[model samples]
Target: MKDPMDLDTPLKPPPAPGSDSPATAAPEARRDRTAPEAQRTDAPKRRSILGRVLAWLVVLALIGGGVWWFAFRPAPEMAARGGPGGFRPGMPTASPVVTATVEKGDMPIRLNGLGTVSSLATVTVRPQVGGQLTQVAFTEGQAVQKGDFLAEVDPRPFQLAVEQAEAQLLRDQALLKNARLDLERYRLLVKQDSIAKQQRDTQESLVQQYEGTVKADQVAVENAKLNLSYTRITAPVSGRAGLRLVDPGNYVTVGEAGGLVVITQVQPISVLFTLPEDNIPAIMARLRDGAHLPVTAYDRTRDRVLATGTLTTVDNQIDVTTGTVKLRAQFDNADQSLFPNQFVNVQLLVDTLAGVPMVPVAAVQRGAPGTYVYVVNGEDSTASVRPVTLGASDGAKTVITKGVQPGETVVIQGADRLREGAKVAATDGAAQPAAPTPSSEGPRPQRRPQRNAS
Candidate 1:
């Protein structure tokens, strides 16, 4: 065991391959001590703090922007400049109402009526004598003249009767001549005492009675002639014939109670109408002043004029029951627009005024202080409250007698939510406003502040 190998072991394996040198350990110790300190010193910590601060600033900016926008924006129903149809709450809205021009032209005061057309002359055709109807000369609906024969009665019996009466009259006349000659002879004999006085007087009385008999025979003959003439029925007046009420061979008679046929005149016709009593004064004044009152009738459904005429006559008194006054108008029946009992609406123009101021009735508002209108004024087109006096109203338009001018623009449909001096926007792209119009009334066409359109 005490060999050389044992001696090497006892020497500790040659100092464990230079473990006794401190220089080598020094390098490892320096590395271990400096590593943690270098890591601590070189780490970028300030960058992380700056990143958190930047993120916070961005979040604050976003929140501030949202708050500012929510607080300052206008509400939804309003428009720019606080007018209608553009943008914010409590602003005006587009109106659905219709409007008309404030014209500076004639304004006619009128009286309207309802009317019907009828003929001037009408007649009924009937038999004048009692007889059998032998012939019908006219058709059922034929036009006739005054003397035209309408029908004929059987003439054989009437002719025979007339001849007999004539024969009797001639016999009476011959007897009358013989009696006169006899009376002359008797008078001469009585004067010569050739005959008694009683005899002469008796002869004279006989002659006078014969003369009366001849006169009576003549009258009978004339009556028979008249009866014969009446057998032929003629039209009493010229007119159009209606449907035949009797046919040929009908037993027509003078005693027949009812009418056989009716006839109506067709040429120049007339219309009867009535107007409310409220329109009477105006119409009468115009008529008295020599103004021609024109009247028109329109078809019911289409509102087209079917006839036109002038006021011919008016009733002396108003109809108290209907609160209406009767009027009659004459029309030329050239187009035959008028028919008997035809119903029509009538527009009677009583009078007209030149250069009168009238506007759409929709612009007139019934305010607390009577009637008023909203007039747009200034360069901003702001609404201004104006009191107005109204004249005649035609349901669609009103005559403004005072307060507003002719050419001024009045707010028609945009006044419900509007206040005085609030802005406006005209729908025809004329949003650019003009100056205020002058205040004078009567005939104003294209006011002084009329500006060029947008």
Candidate 2:
């Protein structure tokens, strides 16, 4: 009755001899057994977590090393070789250049300016007397000489006026002759005591009056002749005729606004130009020395030479507004290359500097120091920077006052790519690249080819 439930439970194990009693040993053993089983079950899980953490740490370390290698790597060529004097070492490529020999010759000092082609004389052919324009004698744009017939007005009216003047003159001459005969008769009667002196004086006075009338008639005839001559308009100057202003059958007058045609003298033409006021003293000095300065006229592009001439005159005063003085140059424009009112470039050779060291203007270069040139050394095919003192320049050549010698070669073309003590491959002729000099930083980096994506 007391252990009907206890009979269903298992029996407890007996304790060892030296150990505590069975009741006490049973509880201790149970606790020890349960602790060991729990520890064994958790061991595998702790080891698995530790392994996972270590694997992640290894992956992170590999990624960091790869990033450093790719970003901080040096170029293959630079890493393979070292440079001298802290500059990268490589075979310097020789720059191709064109050279010119410094020469000892005359360099003309010239003053350049813009100019206008003008006629030595310009005339507007207009009718001197008013009448109907009856004829145009010259063709448009025709060359004409002075006094050449250009146009004609109607001459009928002028002819009639001339005839009337002639008739009047004849009438007055007849009257004068009759009066003179009567005066002669009266003088003879007075001398013979047949007529009074008063009567003779009256006849003499009548003759004088008639003579005066005849003289007046003569003046009228001359005037009428002059007017008739004016009916034929003539070119006042030798020149090329412009377009006709008044057509035939149009009534023209002396007071017309624009003349019949304009004529401009193109041959032996004059060029009107201006130079800075400061140049006046030099120009005047040369002029006083009896030097006939040479002037050259070029087309607008300044490439083609139109004519060569001599300086004719300088204006009296400098223009206050422009600070320039006007100059005139005369050219024998035989080819008619220069036209009236055309724009041109003028170069006046004021003086010549003889026995000066000169070089092509392209050889001169400006830098922080001043003017310089790249002089090619003959001993070694290399170029060196040479400082030079620049004097007068004639556009094509420049005078080098110092630091360069005659017969020495200087780089004219491809100087922009030069450095001090740079090797060069020079050509004898003028054909050379005009590219500018490379910068001083260094040679440009070589580009790398990209790989195709897989």
Residue 160's lDDT within candidate 2 is 94
Model 1, range 344-373, lDDT digits (tens) per residue? 667777777777787776688886867888
What lDDT tens digits, residue by residue, belong to model 2 across residues 1-454? 5685777778777775797985787999899989989999999999999999999999999999999987774322222134554654555656788998999998777788888898889887777899999899899899999988878889999899999999999999999999999988998998899989999999888999999999999999999999999998888888899998989999998867898998999989999998899989999999999999999887765656799999999999999998999999999999999999988888888898999999987899999758999999888788989999998875567899998999999998898777788888898644545545442211222222336782
Winning model by lDDT: 2
Per model, state how many residue pairs clash: 5, 2
Instruction: Provide the lowest-lDDT 10-residue window in model 1.
Output: 439-448
Clashes of 1: 5
Task: Spell out the clash pairs found in candidate 1.
Answer: 77-88, 77-89, 78-87, 78-88, 79-87
Clashing pairs in 2: 416-437, 417-437
Off by over 4 Å in 1: 1-101, 180-211, 284-292, 316-318, 378-380, 393-396, 427-454
Candidate 2 structure, TM-score to reference:
0.66
The per-model lDDT (C-alpha) reads 0.73, 0.85
RMSD of each: 18.9, 13.9
